[model samples]
Target: MPVLILGLVLFLGVHSLRIFADGWRSRQRARLGELRWKGLYALVSLVGFALICWGFGLARQHAVLLYVPPLALRHANALFTLIAFVLVAAAYVPRNHLKAAFGHPMLLGVMVWAFGHLLATGMLHDVLLFGAFLLWAVALFVASRRRDRREGTRYPAGTLRGSALTLVIGVVAWAVFARWLHLWLIGMSPMG
Candidate 1:
């Protein structure tokens, strides 16, 4: 739990800099130069991510039970995860209506993913991981939207094909993860 908390603070704190301290970030970028700054940031993020995974794994071993979620909520979580994957795909695929509509598909996807997990799992580690991510996603989404509004950002109008592609890719990815990757990587299958 201590490691998890520290990792979250380090990871989320670094991520929040652009959202909360744009001026400071810019100054640092300018001082460090873009490549060097990005390199350092990526290194730190990777380390933090490793720590988070390790800590979460250790914390999960303790199995501090919270309220047991209903079986129905697990089903709902599966459905929500499918949609979340679609939104995540939209973030990468260009000119998708989902991206245009949400303006921040990645952050929105995180919200959905975290919320879905929160609904499905009831344990201290689960709550800490998902809840923290949910809060960060919400904050990032709001901050990004505000920044976009300030910049007068406009996403391109997307065609139906783009939307279809996003959906197909997301579903395929979800299927792969639900079927195999989740089990292989996380040692538990979300589908199971």
Candidate 2:
């Protein structure tokens, strides 16, 4: 649990710099130069991610159950996760309506993902992990939207073709992950 907490702090804290200390982040980027800054960022992110995986595995072994959700909610999580995946896809796919409207679909996706997982899983570690992500995503998304508004940022208009492609990619990816990768990597079957 301590290791999991530390990993979340490292990962989420670094990610929050742009929202909380834009000027400081800009200065660091300039001082370090783009390549070096990115390298450093990647290193920290990787280490934090590795810790998260290791700590989550360790924590789950103890199995401190909270309130077990109804089976219906677990089923609903599949739908929530599918939508989350689509929103994430919109972030990468150009000229998508989700991106144009939300201005930060990836953050929205993260929030949705965390929220769904929180509703479905009742373990202490699960709550800690997903709740942290939910809170962080909400904060970051709000901050990002405010920044965009201040800067008068406008996203590109969505094209039908691009939006369709984004939807297709998202669904396929979600299906693959939910059906196979989730079981293989996490040792749990979301569909089952």
Candidate 3:
């Protein structure tokens, strides 16, 4: 649990710099150069991710139960995850309607993903992890939109074709994860 907490702090803290301290982040990037900054960032992110996974596994082994969620919530989680994946896909695919509307589809996706997990899982570690992400995503969303407004950012108008493609990709990816990868990697099946 300590490791997980530490990992979340490290990972999420680094990610929050742009939200809280854009100037400081810019100074560091300027001093270190983009490649070096990226390398350091990647290293820290990897270490934190590894610790999170390790600690989560350890915590799960102990199985500290909280309130047991209703079985129907699991189905709701699957539906939420489907939407989350589509939002995530919108972040990468250019001229997608979701991205155009949201302006920060990735953060919205994170919110959806975290919220879905929170609804389905009822464990101490799960709450701590997913709750933190939910809070962070909300903060990030607010911050990013503010930044966009300040910068006068304008997203391109989206086409139906791009939206359709994003939808297709997200569904295929979600189906693959739900059917096999989710169970294989996360030890749980979204569909089941």
Candidate 4:
């Protein structure tokens, strides 16, 4: 639990810099140069991610139960996760309507993913992990929208073909993850 908390602090704290200290981040970027800043950021993020995976695995071994979620909620998580995948795809797909409508689709996707997991799992470690992500995503999304509004950011108009492609990619990716990757990597199957 301590290790997990540390990982979350390192990961989410770095992520929150833009939200909390945009001016400072800009100054640092200017001072360090874009390449150096990005390299450092990526390295830190990777280390934090490694810690998160290791801590999560270790914590699971102890399995501290908080509440047992209803089977129905676990099933409902599948739907939420599917939508999350679509939103995530929207963030990457060029000229997707979802991206045009929601400037920060990736953050929204993370929020949905965290919320869905929270509903499905009720262990102490699960709550800590998912709840932190949920909170961070909400804050980041709000801050990002505010920044966009301030900057008068305008998204490109989306094409139907692009939107369709995004949807198809998202669905296929979701299917692959749900069917195989989730089971293989996370040791759990959403379908079951």
- For model 2, residues 1-192, the per-residue Cα lDDT tens digits are 988888998888889999888899899999999999999888888888888888899999997999999999999999999999999999999998898899999999999999999999999999999999999999999999999999999999998987998899999999999999999999999988
Query: Which pairs of residues clash in candidate 2, taking residues 3 or more apart in a chain or in different chains?
Result: none
Candidate 1 lDDT tens digits, 79-186: 989999999999988878998888889889999999999999999999999999999999999999988999999998877989899999999999999999999988
What RMSD does each model have against the real structure? 0.8, 0.7, 0.8, 0.8
Against the hidden reference, what TM-scores do the models get? 0.98, 0.98, 0.97, 0.98
Clashing pairs in 4: none
**Model 3, span 70-161: residue lDDT tens:** 99998899999999999999999999899889899989989999999999999999999999999999999998999899999999888898
Regions of candidate 4 where Cα sits further than 4 Å from its true position = none
Cα lDDT tens digits, model 4, 21-68, are: 889999999999999999999888888888888899999999899999
Off by over 4 Å in 3: none
Rank ordering of all candidates by lDDT, starting from the highest: 2, 4, 1, 3
Residue 6, model 2: lDDT of 87
lDDT at residue 162 of model 1 (Cα atoms): 91
